[model samples]
Target chain A: MDKRILVIEDEEIIAEYYKKILQNAGYEVAIFYNGNDALQYYRQFHCPVVVTDLEMPQMSGEEVIGNIKEIDDDQVIVVVTSYYDPATIINIMKKNVYDYIVKPIEPVEFGATIKRAFESAEYRKMKKALEQERILKLERQIEWFNWHESIIQRNYDRVDRELFSNLHESFNQGAGFGSLLTLIRLIASMAKKSNGNYVIDEQMFELIKKNADVAEKILNIFSELVIIMNRTFEFEKVSVMELHSLLRMIIAEIEKYAGIKKMKIALSEQKPPYKSAYVNIESDYIKKAFHEIFMNALKFSKPSTAVMVFVDMKTEGVEILIINTPEIIREGVVGIPVEYENLLFEPFFRIAKVVYEEFETSDYGLGLTLVEKIVRKHGGSISIANILDSSDISRASETKVCVRVWLPLASEASRGERKGA
Target chain B: MDFKKAAESMQLPLDDYLSLVQKFLERLPQYREGIFSAKNSGDMKRLAAEAHKLKGVALNLRFEELAECAKKIEIIAKGEAQIADDVFGMLEHLIMEIKQLMLAKENRDG
Candidate 1:
């Protein structure tokens, strides 16, 4: 095709000079003295190659080029400037030029430069089409990721809440296992990532559990989850303060949900003295296990009652007790730990009938089994006993079921007085 | 006692423990001060960040004893945990130990 070209130069010599070169190169050429004239011609001809001087009286090359582009984006143009300034360069870039030349020009270089410009314009168009395709591909991936994130997040939120009240009702006698709750809160958040992976890796656990303070909490969290996963486990030692702060962050993150569910939790002492307590376990496992337990408890229990969890001092160490009125234990799961029966901590082992009925939605019978395993790993025992019997005079069944978890699971403690594990 | 002097007196590496001690001492004035000054600041989010940072440094250094003290300050800073006279007492003990360590080092070096 005989490409149409426009020459816009303020100097007579440069204008005539461009017309000669483009004409020699087999282009149909038009020449003009000012930006206004070129633009006027441009609007009429819609020439693709409009070579123009940057400095002009009637209108600047930049303004002319901008208008040309707004009119037709595919138009290719070259700018000629006398002196190059940073602003001019930026302005040129913004104006979207094919190529630009400084004065005291070389004819051959200018031709080659213009040729390169045309090639690049073609290249850029191709690249733009390519980039758009890439974005669409990325959009698909993003859409998929967002879908998974939402599902995981929803489950994460729901499970964390369930753990809170359920743990309170089961272990705490209305109030005190603040530190234990802090630890449980963290594990609950981790456990809620339904689509993600959590493992009870021993080495990572050993390193994490070097600190004495948070070891028990970590152990408790991981132990619970490990049982849920039905796997071998190790306890880790990360700071309880970090864990608790994480909890606070999670609480703050899901502040809306807690408010919605009217779920609330308070530390036994408000400000527990032990921030750097040890959680002798893997974080992910503990979090998952504890969250599952709480979720079931909350779902299965009667709402509107404060599920209280508190830590009390025991002669052996600390006792983190999750006291809840189970009011219902279906005979079978926690039944005398019979044949392989030692496997109550297995995934989906709901000892209490209330659990199955309540958490019928996620029929995964592995929450309490996990809690049992988690408690055992901490070298502690969890007993699901009755507190208030169903006072039906004829039936005379226990009304309140107390799942008193005599956890070494005691709450936060003072420095240097750690109970021997 | 000055921490630097304590390390020097005890023949402990002055620079070795100074940074850790320096980090701890940075918050001494905070524990002594007893209250965060951003009274109108809606919450202690920033303070919590600061406290979180202190905890990492405190625990990593294996300054278990000192770390315990910093944890208290962190709680108070968190607004959920309050600072008490005992927290100051712990901070004071850490400062005194570092100072004594420095003094012991200085005496040995001298």
Candidate 2:
């Protein structure tokens, strides 16, 4: 299409003169005798080139130039004027006008300037088209990557399940040894009760019954452990999570244990009208991570101490800090050692055995290990440390352990990205 | 009032040049009112701009004497020259000549 040129001049004859020359050059030309009409014309039709006088009634040509730029900064404009002020010319040039023409304009020179302006307009259009093409190519590449990632994730999950199955089988085979020993003990008690006799006494019968019950409980514990150990995680269903609700769900899972120790779970107040702190994560995996962390905090907290949980909304993410002081480090010990922080998330890693012995608990499970795995899978992080207040250090009994988790926020754009992932 | 000469310079027929001259005459009253208003209000910038516009129109229409007068007035009103009264008088005289030309054509046409 022939490029459109807009001419703005309040002097009727000069405007007509420009219109005639531009029309004769086989260019589409529109003329306005005032700045108002010229600006209106540009707004509606978006002329590629403009020839404007510096001074006009209603609105000045400079204002017209500025307003046109606001609509579309790529417009090519040439300022034509009889005004011989150098300052005024320099000022208009600063506005990025394409060319300046002094009146009475030589027709050849004016036409040449218009041709150059058209070349600039064509360049801008071509550059914009190339930029749009690049964006489309990038979007296509992202789509392909997302598809490839999903396939890889699917295979990884299959391999993970198979590996867990093998591990569980080995564990079950190891538990058979414990089962055999219990049987031998029961058999020994039975043989003694049957010493030269055909019937068992009441006390002997009670002994046999008690041993059977212990065996049953041991088997149940092993089966439950296998179930938890063999659990698999998938990040396919990422969504905006209501962190408060998720946290409450985790707390509820361990509420019975908390009650046994008389440990109150105090949730720090969330900001505002209780709107959910939405985090971008796989909902189930993140929930499982929080549940494990909460369990660990409850298990180690001193009896009757509240497990303090604070959920704060940060600019980049949601920060959840779970703190328990006077926690069980090891039997007589109260605080976790600094070196243990790094090893806390290793699979099957546990605190000192003396802690379990003192508490009379058999399990020091992979809670933190699983929590770290799930957090890292969601592109977030978890940390554990011992924070000592002045009073905590002064008093030998105080041990403050903090478990901090940072989960990135689920912004609208991130949600779109997550869908692709 | 050499209408044929003016038309020849513009490469137009005499009737076309007369039409343009008539249009210029029709706007003369408004131009006169604007010049007087600017002078009475001491608005030198407006006066200069108005005179500059008149200069452009006169030059395009082949009115050489009037264009020269308007250019002088424009220079004076813009404070580039110190001949405001003399330039104003010349501008008025040139405007009267155009008005007389318009009257002569109207009488001849009638």
Return the top candidate by DockQ: 2
What is candidate 2's DockQ?
Answer: 0.14
Which docking category, incorrect, acceptable, medium or high, applies to candidate 1? Answer: incorrect
User: Judged by DockQ cut-offs, is candidate 2 incorrect, acceptable, medium or high?
Assistant: incorrect
lDDT of 2 by residue, A227-260 (tens): 4455443334232235676787778877877887
The parts of candidate 2 lying over 4 Å away from their true place are A142-421, B1-19, B99-110
- For candidate 1, the share of real interface contacts preserved is 0.00
- For each candidate in the order shown, give its overall lDDT on alpha carbons: 0.51, 0.68
lDDT, candidate 1, at A203:
51
Candidate 1: stretches off by over 4 Å: A1-234, A239-267, A270-279, A313-315, A325-361, A389-399, A406-421, B1-110
- Per-residue lDDT of model 2, residues B1-110, tens digit only: 58888766655557766777777887877777787788779898988877777887787777889888878877788788885577677778889988987888789889
What does the lDDT come to for candidate 2?
0.68
Q: Which residue pairs clash in candidate 2?
A: none
